[model samples]
Target: MSDQPAAAEPGRLTTREAAGRLGVKPETVYAYVSRGQLSSRRAPGGRGSTFDAAEVEALAARGARREPPLSGSDLAFRTGVTLIDPDAGHYYFRGVDATELAGRYGYEEVAEWLWTGTLRPGVRFTAPPEALEAGRRAAGALPVHSTAMDRLRAAAVAASAADPLRFDLSPDAVLRTARALIPALVGSLPAEGARDADADRLAQRLWRRLTAHEPDEGSLAVLEAALVLLIDHDLAASTLATRVAASARAHPYAVVSAGLGALEGPLHGAASGLAHRMLAEVLERGGAAPVVADHLRSGRRVPGLGHRLYRGEDPRAGALFALLDRVPAAGPALAAARDVVATTARHTDLYANVDLALAVLSVASGMRAEAGEALFAVARTAGWIAHALEEYAERPLRLRPRGQYTGPQPAQPLP
Candidate 1:
């Protein structure tokens, strides 16, 4: 044999050839690229594009004939979770850490990072003149005087519906829609012209509008911390739902809708609601350890005490609890809640999940009972976009799956 290795069989493959090897159509291959599936770079001195045969082959092999049909939840559960460092945990928009970014950067900057995977060149927040004007107009359109949440939900639904391209799942369109719609939704709520009128001011400003009370620095800080902490958690149920839909090439709004539907359930994101209700019950029974003990003895699980992820203590809970130290009368409820948690932990491995701490924090800060869910909905939007972006990139198989037949088939049409 010659000393030189045998020539590799035409190492270079066009997109069409790569699609053929993968048993998918050319359009499907293009769909993948649009969704950020296969990595590509511009060919040197060429008009057409080129792909790495090795990379394409590896991706195909990994996707080959997997069982149970990949779903969003499956991907989420399988993808390794990077545990956030609670105290030092910083959310970077694209690359900038969130902790550093939140106070320094505007909400628009953060939103851009969440949607586009990175802050595009020259991304910065300037309070939109129209943002305040549009906010006032949107609020006026609502039923004269609605609750803070009413204004928020109305603005969001109306804005989303108005975006003709909201259904488009393509990377460029989704990012464009996000930039246009998100600021409108956040800004156009409650009448403007407040002491602080920066429509671009995110967490604190929004909190002020929602509460209809002067923003308490401590409470606002606590709320912001909660948002920052919970903004993303590895592949959560709702996040998975969004990803799965995105995999199917569903529209971005559709994908987000799927995730929101999943979140609306009691088991997933609504767990915080249960925690709040549980604490309310405890308060009604007199803020005493014995009352909590009796409730536990009666087979009622305290809502916020236990979590599925952290076996000992949830780091987010610890951070929030530490911050609440300065607030007045915030101690008793938290203490009683912790007492219940400790008592329950002796029997189960449950630790205080974020829900419990949030209930305490929100309630202590005097937010309306119904507001926590809305806050959670807002916070989770960040994660929803993150998952959507990933889906846009991966462009995995469609979400539809074959089902196991249990009952008789569609025969005997009219029995």
Candidate 2:
């Protein structure tokens, strides 16, 4: 049998051509083959590989779609707090549609409902005078360069110290702690303007902390909706930490402390700040293309573009954006955000997540970049408490997972 070369296939593409069509390197094309994302055949001369042109185009069209990252543990806990239906592009809190709840109720009302399963209209949370004073003092003592989240952590510690009943794990005591602690967290931050009256809504008090601009009715509504939507989201990392603390019978304050600790990670609470900066840059640069290109060139995933849990737009984001549209001041920043989503969609199927919506609110309201993070921490305090209550009912220390040790054998001699 002769091994002479034959003419090239007309409908096929060489590795180089496929790379060009896919906007990637030939090496990446080979990687796709290894991962079974694409298939290739040996060329007629057996010297190189050839890909079907149709297949290459199809793979490129699929873009960056991927499965949600695994949490590395098989353990699951049953809870009635929140349900996220990714396929339906919606989430619910306690059997009620979360977006609808945000629309119809205030932050305090939703939070109260989540805690007790009873809807109390016109409910409000007030910071205890002693707890608020202690929190302010502790937060004020932090270095000048400390962030809003830093202040929140410091306040949590001091507030825990100020409460004589912090060690009480009873349901009623825990509820009292949550209500007072959330307001204390908000009050701890140095006010950016004249302090709001204690009787004001939580969103109004929080607004005073975030920006000096006077709050309009529309903007306050957006802030309230953000809080309601953020109240809980199934067991996030911080929620898990809060539950673990509760499993060990930690007091409500300490469980919240645990949650705040976990929330400080960049991949979690800090993500919105990154999105804020990105949106600002897009606005300054007068386009999303170059800013997005810079992020891609530096190998950074575009912030606020996607959520692992939602295959489409994050429901929380959708709800917030709908409200933001009514705020005239949000017009420019909102357009910038939309540009970011549209630009990224050219190469990937990602949709805007809650972080992006938060960035829009922060940017348009003249708030600092970290404002979104503070909002997340404050709102999620209620959720942490809800989970703590559930964990308190479970067997004590039930969350203690046995580690599968994969180190030196027990029989090994000490060095």
Candidate 3:
């Protein structure tokens, strides 16, 4: 749209050359431009267009950034995991909108979607009867103060022992075992047995295990939505650890163990539970301003307040809060959550994230103080397994990074 004649800049490419670089038809190149996925400028004589060669190449390579590696600092690695647009407060699971998917589906349905890139309904995740019994026995062996995550780790070991096909790496074999692990994990929690009638629904079963009370459909729906929302986020720290293990061709159980180890850290999966502890005080104090002021004054972060990815808002938090607002039993917790957000907004630019929503769910449902963390761990298993599958399809040990030597010279080269 320039008045003067347009001339191609050095290092840029004509339309045809851009298409060739991308290995796509010229029409496809135009489509990318139309969608703002790629940028192009008018060619010489104001005729066609010349695309930025670097932009076309980056698009072709999909996330390979040209930035130099910042050792022990921020990084961005190319991945084909779930796509998130935090500026828009939305994400997609393999191209499907996560909010839409969560609205109409349950956990395993979304899990299958993440794993196979297809939405198949009525899929069930259940293990053999004896396998559940084995997990229960393993969980029961843990001490009183041990966490639900500890019980899950113990149960994972027992279930691996029970599965004779645990080592099979075939796609079908891996998926079959993955399905079985979810149910076995659900049955492993330290809670009452499931009745025959409601045993078919994974959410219902998990509710019994976590709460030790009768399952309510509304709360179950909220849990399902949470699971779907948390299913897979691209290249999270725990997911990176999971892929590293999978790159070594470790079995799914071991991959899950690696993920659990990463999730145990306070900076990752445990943040939600910590938020719950802080929010519990809000519920008791009947106000959040004092709690927020105290946290800010102490130079401590308001737990579950904001996210690095989400610039405007967190869609996961929005989705979960919408569902929780409908449950009458969630009143007190929802009130406290509202206060937390309002108070934090006045003091800082931070907003509520998925962890805050998860903490709110814990308080409302009267689940254990640590239940938020356990829920995050359980929901993220779907993502961890999906990432493992993706890693297994790639060349092994592809995640190894070149370490820059920073220490004293290594003993003068072993002289």
Candidate 4:
């Protein structure tokens, strides 16, 4: 046999050539690209695209070697998560168009897509009877006149306490419980006796029932959009907390409670509320430009300006701001907030994360600043459920952390 290496294929192979090599049709190649299953680079002259032979071979090898089959963990490992991509220098959501989704889809649709593998065309949550009782119990446990979010958390805690079966961490049970509970979680918002629970009507009723004032069509639409956009983003700190609970084989509600505990911290769920309050403070003091400049000069970190991910812009912020634009900016507060954002953008690489934008949107929508954190918790519960589902499906063993011993060796027994 000749000792020479195989001859290099001429130029770049089209999709047809690449697919032919892979023993699949060209359409399959397009699908691969669409799902982010394959990578291709733009050509020098830009006629189409080129795929490296070595890269394709590596991908094929990886595909062949996949054991878990890249189901639940796909979003966690791939593009646009907490760590910004070194190549793209931005985050993405499951390779879906985050910008478009943020702009186009309501928050509910976005959330549904996050939880299930795909966005169902006309899916709805229908609650079971147990859910209504759970909802009533949850409502009573919350502090009177608390934020809507607080009531929801308290309800979740109460409902968990009420259910003996809740502690069971079986995957199917967890999902069933979540499906039964989420609508009630939302529905129980209007103070126990004031509202009645019927699972099918809970989401719709709660939307109208929770708001302190009547929601105009635009405001309601914006609120729905916010819910969708805030629904999930890979493994946030709270999501991680839920996963940890799941790893411990905690039930779904317990897992969510774990997530809520994490969210209570200032660095996580409370950040947006802080941002909202800070913006209000700035607006109250004078105007956005001066307050922002003073903040920068004083070395005070502006709330809602920086994020761990998204160097240029937070996709959620862009989506929210665009939605907010539909409403009139009638007062100094609106202009000031905008000015602060504009000025802050000039100095820092970080733009507003979801919290900052949510703060502004919440205020614009007439939600009390105190209640904003609770709303955020509600929005994020969807993600917690998604993570819990993944963890339950994987059936991970109990979480037991190993620690390096730093203390002195054991002494003799005490007298």
TM-score of each: 0.66, 0.82, 0.79, 0.71
Alpha-carbon error at 17 in model 1, in Å? 22
- Model 2, range 1-415, lDDT digits (tens) per residue? 1211244489888777887888875545554553345666667756456778888888888872342443664247767688889999999987789999999999999887777655668988988899999999999999999999999999999999999889887655677798999999999999997768747999999999999999999999999999999999999999999999998999988998899999999999999999999999999999999999998889999999899999999999999999999999999999999999999999889999999999999999999999999999999999898888777765588776798989987888878
Give the Cα-based TM-score of candidate 3 against the true structure. 0.79
The predicted structure with the larger TM-score, 1 or 4, is: 4
* Alpha carbon lDDT at 78, candidate 2: 60
Q: What would the per-residue lDDT of candidate 4 be over residues 1-415, giving only the tens digit for each residue? A: 1111233245445555566666654444443443345555544453334556765666667762243644544334322222335235444555565656655665555555554333544455655656667776767666667666566777787677767788665433554577666766776666322444343232344455444555566656656666666666667788878878876778888888888888888888788777778778776776667767777789888877766765666777777677777766423445656777777777766566777776776666565664457666767777677666556544356345567998777894775
The Cα RMSD of model 2 versus the native structure comes to 22.2
lDDT of 1 by residue, 43-76 (tens): 3443333456886788688873232554654433
Candidate 2: list runs displaced more than 4 Å. Answer: 1-74
What are the Cα lDDT values of the candidates?
Answer: 0.58, 0.87, 0.77, 0.62
Ranking by lDDT: 2, 3, 4, 1
RMSD of 3: 12.2
> Where does model 3 exceed 4 Å of error?
1-78, 192-199, 412-415
Instruction: Show the colliding residue pairs in model 4.
Output: 80-91, 80-92, 107-228, 138-155, 149-374
- Model 4, C-alpha of 384: deviation from truth (Å): 1.6
Candidate with better TM-score, 2 vs 3: 2
Score candidate 2 by lDDT: 0.87
Query: Sorted on TM-score, highest at the top, how do the candidates line up?
Result: 2, 3, 4, 1
Reference-based lDDT, residue 234, model 2: 90
- Superior candidate under TM-score, 3 versus 4: 3
